[model samples]
Target: MFWSAEADTSAVLLAQMPVVLPAAANLYSALREPAAREDEDGTHFLFEAGGQTIRIARLAGVPPEIPLAAFVPLDADGFDRMEGIGRLLRALQGRTIPDDHRLTPQQKRRHRHMLQATDGRMNGATYRDIAGVIFGVDRVASEHWKTSALRDATTALVKDGLAMIAGGYRMLLRHRRRS
Candidate 1:
């Protein structure tokens, strides 16, 4: 699900952390079906555990076999980096990861609707037609097409979905801050 290295801020950076030889605790044994790749930046590992994907990165010069003590930077993204390290720690310790980080049911439903509406529009469906599918057909029929709130809602959903598809969805990973 994390398609881009720049967008996915959840990676636990091993190179930045303290390296321990003959590690007392290691991530290699605890992760499930870990997939690894090497690039100019580092060695990257992706795995699924505790109902979420865990991403780990080691910088180019770091040894791949060593265990790293989690190190978090005190910056704008400190909280997110801390959270990622916390999840990695829990996984390494054979402890259950908490599910409190997931999105709410309402947010999920709205995102679903946004994608559906965007799909309909891309396939040449009118906003009214999309509204009929999302809202009940009878409800769409009851309102005047020229001055319907559903029309505006359907339009907004498509616009929002398009923005997400255009890479704005990356914002979903970080905590919101007042600007």
Candidate 2:
């Protein structure tokens, strides 16, 4: 694919992005079945918890950048309350993520970079402190350019087994304990 000169690259630029949104909120995926949790109805309950904007669209193969777009100007909490879109988004939240899972070399490096940049702490950082370096921005970023990071990060984490629906089924990241 070729880059568009007039395109809003900053809106989709991952490196220059911020981390403050749910790292795992994304496009349509099957809602989680209750197993590890008690009587969890995943999506249905997630939207009700209410705090983000959510929506759905068809895709043969959506670029990682597209979902990141959702984060900007419309974080999950914005859509989480919408009548039509919220249902679709809530249904698409990913299930549990594992702790021991490894990240892609690039992602691993990014995580390291974040740790270093923040000096391994998030005193003033929003998502960074709360979600750690990787998830901190991913959970709270609803700006245009950062949306893809939110989408891709969440999807990657879930696929690699690093996140989960908390007891309340709000998108909760697999938090790392500080040493």
Candidate 3:
């Protein structure tokens, strides 16, 4: 699930979204892509002007090679997108999604380390160092010094990244590598 920080919105990213490289993404380069659908036959997601795509099957352990039977149309809205996303997932449970292009272990680790480490922690500061390195403009002059800086900073640090939010923050810092 993805949260719209500014919009206070929570939604899951469809498995079939057009992601850059090998990750998942919306086909139209958008999370909420405008697609055609139908409640009767199934849902339809239009990737291109005339290319209407449907969820044939999900690729997980074993990739589903079949294409959707036909284009099923539906309403275009959060509720609709949400419902459609749900149906697609339900129908695709346990399927082997082709995430052949996901990040390498080292790359993901680096990304995590970057998000977890901040400039302050290295100096062994307190409260001001709460945000670690990613946060804290300057330990001495941090605007949040007087406020609940540490608490809020910790939240933001832990809340960094798509999977962090999508996975419901269940994943802990497995390891911290100094970059």
* CA-only RMSD, every prediction: 3.1, 21.7, 15.7
Q: Using lDDT as the measure, what is the rank order of every candidate, best first?
A: 1, 3, 2
Best by TM-score: 1
lDDT of 2 by residue, 43-156 (tens): 111222133322222222333253332322354333222323333433345332222222356756655544443433324433323334455554445444345555455344
- lDDT (tens digit, per residue) of candidate 1 on 1-179: 33344455667776633443555645644544346777887777775667877777766787655555555667777777777878888877768987645457787798899999999999999999999999989999999988999999999999999998998777777654435
Greater-TM-score candidate between 2 and 3? 3
lDDT of 1: 0.74
Give the TM-scores of the predictions, in the order they appear: 0.83, 0.17, 0.25
Highest-scoring model, lDDT = 1
Between prediction 1 and prediction 2, the one with superior TM-score is 1
Q: How much is 93 displaced in model 2, in angstroms?
A: 4.8
Each candidate: what lDDT?
A: 0.74, 0.32, 0.36
* Deviation in Å, model 3, residue 85 alpha carbon: 13
Clash counts per candidate, in order, are 0, 42, 23
Q: Output the better candidate (1/2) by lDDT.
A: 1
lDDT of 1 at 155: 94
